[model samples]
Target: MSGHSKWNNIKRKKEKTDGQKAKIFTKIGRELAMAVREGGSGDPAVNSRLKDAIAKAKANNVPNDNIDRIIKKASGEGNSDAYEAIQYEGYGPSGVAVIVETLTDNRNRTAGDLRHYFDKFGGNLGTTGCVSFMFQKKGVIVIEAEGLDEDEVMEAALEAGASDFQSDGDVFEIFTEPEDFSAIRDELAGKYTFVSADVEQVPDTYTAITDPDLIVKMGRLLEMLEDNDDVQSVWHNWENADDAE
Candidate 1:
């Protein structure tokens, strides 16, 4: 499995915890709000961003009532939280390349929090393109593997314009060009259940922390970053990502 798929599998297990699920819902809700404000409409039919956000929220198993409420609030007047997307690139312990993406109303607070997490956890933040050059943005759709044949899923996904497909024991992962993700996911959704569907930063290279001490610090860094409400996503090619299972 690629880095993106592996990290997603880890998160899937974590979602079983109510606290973690609540955090996931909060993150998705923020994305939904941002989509509505930026896309200028709550109707997913006309707003591509909102449409994608709704699909992701559904894939994450968020309740429809919550989704409806978020959409209504986002589309109404006086929803004044204006979040701007910001990305921070840095290196974690053992020189693991890390990227933290955020939707923040206050840039300074988000940046400072991210910097502190990196510095206090044995890493250093860098300029905009420092580690981003090693990552690619792609659309990833994950489906539970239960009762599904890998070959069958591969064939259908290929026909629907997926760039790649893999069955990673617990889940079937489909990759697509960012532009094709929504269309392909919509096609697959008709016949299969999804674990998740989102556009994500995928790493081209992985950094392994062989030293046990570095691993501990790296893990803590990831936890702190993920716990931040402003942080939307964190991408890193940590070799032991599957260890989270």
Candidate 2:
């Protein structure tokens, strides 16, 4: 499995904790709002971003009524002006390149908070494009592999334009070019139960941070960013397995 996948599994394992679930809901809600605003419609059939957002919400077990209410409000143009997508680049502990994706109403507040968090956690936020060059944006889809054959899935995914396929436990992850995401997703829609699907910047190479203290500091920084309402996702090049027990 990729280091990204491993770190995700660790986070997922932690989601059962009460405090973490609240943070997860906040992040998902922000994503839904941003998606609805950007797509300009709440109808999933016509809005690709909204469709993905709904899928993610369902995956996280977000309340159906809450999801519907958000869509209704978004469609009616009440909160559309309050959200904007922003990207931030930086270096985490041990010089691990990091990229943060956020949807915020107040850019200044988000920027200041992010910088403060980085400084507090032994990292520094850099200007745009400073660390992004070390990564490539790609679409990743994770599906339960209970009823599917790994080899068959791999073959199908490759034929459907997937760039890579990996099995982590009973989960199968399919990666594709950003443009090919919807095509691959549509092809496998009914064949598997998709756990989560999203576009992310995958680091081209990892910075192996073997020091335990540095790893703890980096993880703390990532958690802090993830907890922020404006922050949607955080990506970095640090390989945690080298230091994580």
Candidate 3:
């Protein structure tokens, strides 16, 4: 598995704890709110972004009741939070490419915190397009491979419009074109339970850091970024990212 997928699998395990789960719920809630406001509708039938956000929330095991409540609150007149979507590109230890996606009410505060994190952990935040050109946006869906037949899963994914299928010993990953991600995910949803279902930045190439000190700093950098309330997703190109463990 790639670093992005591997980290997500690790995060999935971590989210089994109440504290981590609550943090994930809060992050997804912000995403839901942004979808509703930007898409201009609470109804998933009419709002594609909202539909994708709800699917992502459900895949993360968010309750149906909570989903409905969030949509309702977000669309209500009483809700006035104006979150802006921002993308930050940077390099981690040994030039490990990193991309962070955030939704924040205060741009300055978010930028400062992120800058501080990078500097504290032996990395530096870069200009908007610095590392982004190294990645491609793809819809990635992960399903537990246990008790599942590889051939069958591969066939189903290909038939459902997945561009590629891969198994990383623990889970099956299905890749889809950005434009076709939602449709492919919906098609496979009826038959398979997802560990993760979302469009993500996928690195075209990967790098590794061998120095132990740099490895620790890289791990801390990622940890702080993920724990930030404004950060929704973090993608990286570290092949030996498991070293962070």
Candidate 4:
């Protein structure tokens, strides 16, 4: 398995062990709020960014009522929460490039927490663009393979404007241009239940950490980033020894 799938495995375990579903709602809520401010509209029909956010929330199993409520509340007055989207780039143990995407109102607190986690776990947060160049932003959509024909899924995804498609025996992955993500996802939504559909930072390369000590520290570094409330998504290029083998 690739590191992305391995990390998704870790995330799945963590979410079930804790109340991470509620945390996911909060993160998507912040995204909806920010999308309204950035796009200056509550109607997803007119605001493409809001449309994408709504789709993402829905794909992740957020209730339609909650999505509507968040957008409506954000469009009204007296809502003082303005989330700024900031990305932190860094190098983890074994020089694995890490990029943390966050939506937060308090930059200082977020910065301090992220810095502390990196420093404590043998990683160092770097300046902007320090590690981002090693990555590319892409729209990735995943669908479970159970009770679904692989060929049908592949055909549908391709017909819906997906640039590439792959299956790992248990799930199908669909890739598209960032601009085509929303439309392609919407098209597939009519036919399949999405495992996840979002724009993600994909690393161009992977760094394999075979040393057991650095592997444990890297795991800690990832956990700290994942547990933070302000963190929306954590992207890295670290490959485990098992994957390397």
Candidate 5:
């Protein structure tokens, strides 16, 4: 499996743990708020960010009523606080580069929490742009390949302007430029059922960390960062250990 796919699978497993679902909900809520604030419209048809947020919320089983209420509240002047999107760069265990994307009402609180997590996990949060250069922003869509032919899927994705395509087990992952995300997704709407689609910072190269102890520490640090209400996504360059079972 590719490093990106492996990390995604690990994230899926982590989300199944107790209390993590609530964190996921908070992140989605923040995303929805930001989308509404930026797009100036709550209608998904005119706001791609809002559309992606709603899709993610629905995928997570967030209730329709709650979604509508949030959108309504955001559209009006109802307690909708503007959130600033911040990106923090750092190094995790084994000197692996990591980038954290967060939407926060207070930058101080978010920065403090992030720095503490990195320090506690034997890593150091660096200045902005320190580690981001090692990665590229791309839109990734993962779909179930249970009954679909890999070749056919590849053809469609390529025709839709995908940069790369790969399969691991029964899942097919499609990568495209950030600008081409919506078009590619629309093109494949009726052709494939996607497991998930989101924009991510993909690492150009991976740092291999084989020690089990350090791997556990890195995982804990990542989990803590992800659980923060302000944190939207975390990207790292650590490769899955070959001995991981």
Candidate 6:
């Protein structure tokens, strides 16, 4: 993980086409709905999960109207979309550990599509615990670093319960234990704009694919998984993923 870059990943997502942006919006909407259901409240103040989901939606440029509408709908009766959270662990090319997180109403369809993608790209989907051992879940908060003072931000983050802080090229990454994520994020939100705020599966180590063919295949595998509507997040241990992007 020596060269891992979170800012680069944010830039890539921001540069995607409008169609892709729509998919992202849809995925976040699903997240909002789930948050409301799981938290049993539409009010972000009372429902921490819904508050965190709203922050993530805003960071991705989701409009206020859209966010409110989604929450209202999710809280209302007659909301029938029942999405189950599923995590699939596997290996990408060259033994790179991969984890795909999804929210799906139909497990059969999602599983089959993911299996095909992995197989076609020289990887294979494995059991639930197959590759998850290599990862730890943490809350990640990113703020743009254009004019912010790193020392000030780091101090505030640490004081607010963040466990780690790093300044990437164009963003500051603040990490916290999963349990402290919401509190820290809410504290920082009062003063700074977020680029992204969400709990994520972070890799413990990194792998690099030296073979050109495997590199190409690994890239495609990730793309396919990300493009799927059911997939909420994809985490991997590819150290050179910045180059692939």
Best-fitting candidate, scored by lDDT: 6
**Poorest 10 consecutive residues by lDDT, candidate 3:** 1-10
Off by over 4 Å in 5: 5-18, 241-245
Model 6 Cα lDDT, one tens digit per residue, 122-212: 9999998988998999989889989999999999999999999998668889999999998898899999998888898888888989998
TM-score of each: 0.93, 0.89, 0.95, 0.91, 0.91, 0.95
* TM-score-superior candidate, 2 or 3: 3
lDDT of candidate 4 over 60-81, digit per residue (tens): 6789999989999999998898
Q: After superposition, how far is residue 4 of candidate 6 from its true place, in Å?
A: 0.4
Runs in model 1 deviating more than 4 A are 1-16
Candidate 4: C-alpha lDDT: 0.84
Ranking by lDDT: 6, 3, 1, 4, 5, 2
Worst 10 residues of 6 by lDDT: 1-10
Give the alpha carbon lDDT tens digit for every residue of 108-194 in model 1.
Answer: 999999999999989999989999999899998888888988999999999999999877687888999999999998999899987
RMSD of each: 1.9, 2.4, 1.7, 2.6, 2.3, 1.7
TM-score of 1: 0.93
Q: Candidate 4 at residue 89, lDDT?
A: 94
lDDT of each: 0.86, 0.80, 0.89, 0.84, 0.82, 0.90
lDDT of 5 by residue, 1-245 (tens): 22544536544644475577777777788888788989989999999889878987886667888788888888897664789999999998899898999999999999999999999998999998998898888888888888889999999999999999988876888999998987788788778877777778888999887778888888788778877889988887878733333
Q: Indicate whether candidate 2 or candidate 6 has the larger lDDT.
A: 6
Candidate 1 local distance difference test against the native: 0.86
How does residue 224 of candidate 2 score in lDDT? Answer: 80
lDDT of 3 at 78: 78
